[model samples]
Target: MTISDYASLLADAGDYSGRDDVAHLFPRFLALAELKLNRVMRVADMEKTATVPLAEGEGSLPAAFLEARQVLGADGRALRALPLQEFNSNGTSAGAPIGYAIVGAAIRVRPKGGENIRLTYYAKIPPLTAEAPSNWLIEKAPDVYLYALVEEIAIWERDAAKAGAAEALKRQAMAGLGLADERLRWGNAEIVIGGLTP
Candidate 1:
């Protein structure tokens, strides 16, 4: 999945509608959970460039996955991201039709309050032809490419929600005295925990 694949839909985004705790970003997280890993395999089987002509078309999954392999070293695990760039369909180069084997995009998390978290995703795409995945193509156009992009954005929003909730929890905990430490202190009313002795 591209960075936008998750960042756009992440619940706690720069412009999240539900800015509450993770509770508000539930829709975002659900979107992440909704994205299926199997989509990659689906992308791989897409029609080949040889068959559909450059005019045919894409898989964000394949492109992103391949990029992941290169960046993450093909360990086959999803990488945690700190978004900086979101994938955007540059759109075909006029009269180019769909000139990609598979298209991949990003859902970037732009640092608003000062965080550069990014997530990038990749996918494979086959050419647009009868051989291309039947479910994604209709008539002669590759509408499936658009669907893939939208799906990626939704996933990004979900991840954002998770990040926001976690950040809030951390803030709340750090701002208050922990109960465990107090209990351990017990009778040691003025114990020196880590101070240097003069």
Candidate 2:
């Protein structure tokens, strides 16, 4: 389903098609929907990898980065991210980074140097738009998106009954997501326990 499709459902939920109050809030609803989906499930589509330049004991995370899953060196060896105190204790001039730390918006590495590092992480899902009418949530499990949007709208309108119904739907969608995730895990026998399942 597209954003427009979800919006149509929302409109029919409360007859909001022409209501300026609801129409104006559709964008906000969509934003809330994406946020909720991100919180509820991790889809393969949101997994991303980016190369970050390490300099001055740090590297900038990608703009769309949500949370780091792992960091790898040029040779593809996993680099452990260090605790803040450990990284700080090692001092900024430490030769080669044995680990990294998420310091504010930047990644602080131990033994900082100039090397391009690979960061694997969950990415922030792009909001749906007219031109870019769909996303992972819309394609894989639009019910989750639809229910989340409806829940947001219900809360915005202060309709307790509607909000409760939407919440139930959201739970149902989450259950489906969990089953899908487990199925993927079960199908891939050689997958690393803590690594990405393919």
Question: How displaced is residue 15 in candidate 1, in Å?
Answer: 16
Please count the clashing residue pairs in each candidate, in the order shown: 56, 2
Tell me, by lDDT, which candidate is best. Answer: 2
Candidate 1 residues lying further than 4 Å off, grouped into runs, are 1-141, 159-198
Q: Summarize candidate 2's per-residue lDDT along 1-198 as a digit string, tens digits.
A: 233454455555344322346766787787887777776466566789999997776788888878888898766778897777887887746455678889778987677777888899988887776566666666677677667777888888788988898889888987897788778767666745786777
Model 1 clash count equals 56
Model 2 Cα displacement at 155 (Å)?
0.2
**What TM-score goes with each of the models?**
0.16, 0.82
